[model samples]
Target: MNLAENTLANADFMIEEIKKKLRMATGSALKATKLNDEQYEDLKDIYEMVAGKTQFSISEIEAITTELGRLRKA
Candidate 1:
């Protein structure tokens, strides 16, 4: 595979990982309180953001992961 294809594949994998994490988090939160309309809206927003349907690119997963690392470090 070429560089662009490899990069896209990595991004897709990262997106899937993020979706999995989000699902876990949302599930835990739901166990606490049934997802209200606002909560569902927030989850949808998060899904769009991570899935790159908004102003983000699929490749942005790397940047996001990096930023998360930095936040954890701090």
Candidate 2:
């Protein structure tokens, strides 16, 4: 293959590898987590507010619950 073709193939491989790693990380995070009702409610509220208004990240929701829980105990 030519240099350009080889470079494109390498980029595609890297992209697929990144996507696989992300999927594994997300699945691991979900498997390791257990959210209480309050956290679920908070997540629900967040989901509603940003349902179509913005892009949602699971880690952000996790961070919100973690921060809120810490705040409540302080």
Superposed on all Cα atoms, the candidates' RMSDs to the truth, in angstroms, are: 13.5, 15.6
Task: List model 2 lDDT by residue over 1-74, tens digit each.
Answer: 23123243433333333335334343223210344445444434433343334443788656544543442343
Tell me how many clashing residue pairs each candidate has.
Answer: 0, 0
Q: What is the lDDT of candidate 2?
A: 0.39
How do the residues 1-74 of candidate 1 rate in per-residue lDDT, one tens digit apiece?
A: 23123243433344354547544332221221233344334434444466554445555655655543333333
Off by over 4 Å in 1: 1-18, 21-33, 53-74
Question: Candidate 1: deviation at residue 74, Å?
Answer: 26
TM-score, per-candidate, Cα-based: 0.32, 0.31
Residue pairs whose backbone atoms clash in candidate 1: none
Candidate 2: minimum summed lDDT over ten consecutive residues — where? Answer: 24-33
